[model samples]
Target: MTYRMLALSIDGTLLRSNSRLSRQTKDAIEYVKEKGVYITLATERPFPAAKKIAKALKLDNVLITHDGGFIASDVDEPLLSRKLHEDKTFHIAEILENYKCHIRLLHEQFSIGNKVRQKNQLIARMTLGIQDPLYYPVTFVDSICEHLMENPVAPPKIQAQFFSAEEAQAASMELQKEVPSIDTIVRGERLEIVPKGISKARGVQVVANHLGISLEQVVAIGAGVNDIDMITQAGLGVAMGNSPEELKASADWITRSNDMHGVAYMVKEVFRKQLKVNI
Candidate 1:
């Protein structure tokens, strides 16, 4: 039962509690790769963060990043991208401003414009020993109106994340009630605002097309609502055990919790049981 490919999601799926892969998980993934399985990742994380994990796994593969907004082999130069229409991007910013909510706009490697200042508290909370906010210098948008009028090249922002999920859900629901065209969903701690019908599932399809792999041969795993599309698309959609019930219900299988080394568990199960590709 050899798999043509395996596309894993990051965050709550692969990386363990400390935001790092455990030895077991690392070895299991490496083992499957040794068995000639094509391994890749689909993540909402920007290329910078995604690449590090890819290299760590020694997968020697490209990633689908920006929730599938861009696909780059080097993670430096994208091969394909689905950017939001400029006017739509502008409206997104305006919506956030009108709602009196804070937002951040990502450019190439880091943020291009900031909607709100990054106070120490915000920075500390974002980092949370999981990531270094200082890894990339972020610019503040300051005035929402100014950014829209200036139209300073939105450049296909990877994500527009709100500070909190509940707040994002609430705000997005309100916006959609008014606009009826807005697409908003939680990705980890933030709510992602994108033009309707854009998602990691669409992103992975871009990657799959480039690789000549059909959805039937590509397995995907994740733990968040944002991951629903990808999970629904994969040949084997695996949900993390700790994921919300809705997500689990949508998955083909549920792996262990992230803290319990779930990624490693599934890596072993897939190869040993399902794929039957000895490692």
Candidate 2:
């Protein structure tokens, strides 16, 4: 089938292991765009962080960021945004406080969290390991629950970082049972909690509706569990070779890893035929 749009996940799919974009990948994206295919990023990052990547890629389409909670272009207002209720956000924080984790509340453009350096030092190390322009802007307060209680505003999502995958999974299971209204997604030791029904697939649907395209004409590439919905929902779902086994099992095709310019390989090898491009 013919494809008109491409939705990509930034962290593990587009960016290399060092969190930098390769020249071949950039050129391939530009080439696909020249062939009349629209491309945009769908990530768990907020707008400020995602915008930098979009700019570097020269993408002009609306981006699906905040794990599908916010969608907008550089020039336009957010076409769609889903925020958690203030009470729900506070309750989530309260529940998370029982675990040995660092919690960060995600706003539209920035993130705020409690100062638990000891608990989240590993996350800091992981963040420092990645290269420039991929980091999120974060503010640490003394008490995140108290801060939210005093200044109540609906945030799009909450992210928690744990030292071990077991801790993360346990916390996720408890949160899922206690807070059924929220959706929990675990990526290694990082757990993301967003409003129920919010996902990359839903975000893509919003983008598709805005652009007047069909779901069957969309292609999604990602490397994480958060991307599973969109991967299964899109007409062509691609998983990076570096992706988890679960993700690869769900994908229609598996390309090389992100560091090897998997996106470029997918576009040049798999998609070019569908687009009917000789170049």
Candidate 3:
């Protein structure tokens, strides 16, 4: 299919387990870029965190962050931004307080999280600081609901880190039932909440439309549940070897594990074949 765009999920698909980008993967992306294929990061991370990797990869295209709730190259200028309504945020935070978890509200410019119960965790303490150009700004308050009650923000995403998988599942279920306008994504004990119609597939369509391309001319690669729709809807959907069975089943092809340079292998092998190159 003469693919023109390569949409990649960041966390488990592009980065190795240790969060490092391999040289082979860098080369692979450059190779495809030389062939005129546009690359975009389809991630659940905020723009600053995602933008760091995009800058490292030297991608000039826009990124789909907050699980497609926000799409933009710069935080100040966004092509698309879908945030949880202020009233809904208030209700969601109120519901979250009923459970034991670390809550975070992700905004394009900064993030606000709760520090009520996570005071003992060292990492959590360090994450409370407001970072700037170095990292996305994040701050902590005693109560997210209280902060929201006073500040009243419509954030792109809300996250909760529960102590157990069971608790996470239960909270997710409750949120789903109570809030009909939101979508909940579970990754281990972390629950990510975003507004509806904010899947990576929709982000792909947004990027495609902006670039004057079609979904059939895109190659979607990912390794998580959030990526399932993007992988299925693209012309060529690739799942990493390390991906869960559900994602693997949805993929048109499965590449090597991220640690084994899966992205490098897939791009060189497939794009080379498409170009009819002997290499």
Candidate 4:
């Protein structure tokens, strides 16, 4: 067997502790590249945050980000994108407000919020550290709310993220009742909401089509609930040993935990075990 494309989820799947890529992960990716496989990263991170990782692998290729709301290449050109309906965006804000959910409206990383929570502050730090071009500070918390209230126009929601898992699940359930036309998932503890019919799997299809590779030739690996769609859709889904039970169940194979070089192990598995396409 042989795989023509590999679509990898970031966060728990690729990065190790501290949101940084390990030398081990880098070397594994580099080795795969050397073996002439087309590697494309699929991430919920915006292009700016995703680019650095792709660059580290010296992979000048296209990748997906913002769940399935955005796709771009090594350069800043858009390949595909989708936005939530404006009415739905406003409706979600209204519903979540009643639940006292701390929310942020993201349009390519330009976030508007009632207040800047610790999580937003952390994301800002990470964005700045990576020098992400899509990153921008819209306004102070109070000003942002004031502007939204006065404008009365729904912003294009590239991403709407909740700061907590419990709150997100609650909000997701509520939104499902009022408006089910949205794609929602959990990235780590954060709840991510995107336009309906958009997801990492859809993103994978786009990249696969571009490469002329069938879905059966793609392998996706992940560790969180957010990766469920990607894991199930890929031909051979591999879960990290540390992944949640539900996620592990969705995967066709499981490997060592991330801290134990799970990615390296899986890379070797593809070449030496599953595909037997010796590197």
Candidate whose TM-score is highest: 3
Candidate 4 local lDDT, 198-276, one digit each (tens):
7788898998887788888888888877788887888889899889999998999998888888999999877654333
lDDT of each: 0.69, 0.82, 0.85, 0.70
Q: What is the C-alpha lDDT profile of model 1 across 54-145, one tens digit per residue? A: 88888767677766766676746687666656666666666767553456555447655443444433331232124323456655656655
Residues 13-89, model 2: lDDT tens digits: 88998888999999989888877887889998877778888889998779998889888895238898888999988
Q: After superposition, how far is residue 102 of candidate 4 from its true place, in Å?
A: 2.7
Runs in model 1 deviating more than 4 A are 113-133, 158-167, 174-182, 187-189, 273-279
lDDT of 1: 0.69
Top model by lDDT, which number?
Answer: 3
Model 1's C-alpha root-mean-square deviation from the true structure amounts to 3.9
- Of 2 and 4, the candidate ahead on lDDT is 2
lDDT of 2 at 228: 85
lDDT of 2 at 4: 87
Question: Backbone collision count in every prediction?
Answer: 2, 0, 0, 0
Which of the two candidates, 1 or 2, achieves a greater TM-score against the reference?
2
- Can you list the residue pairs that collide in candidate 2? none
Encode model 3's per-residue lDDT on 167-201: one tens digit a residue: 88999999999998899987778888999878888
Better of 1 and 2 by lDDT: 2
Q: Which of 1 and 4 is the better model by lDDT?
A: 4
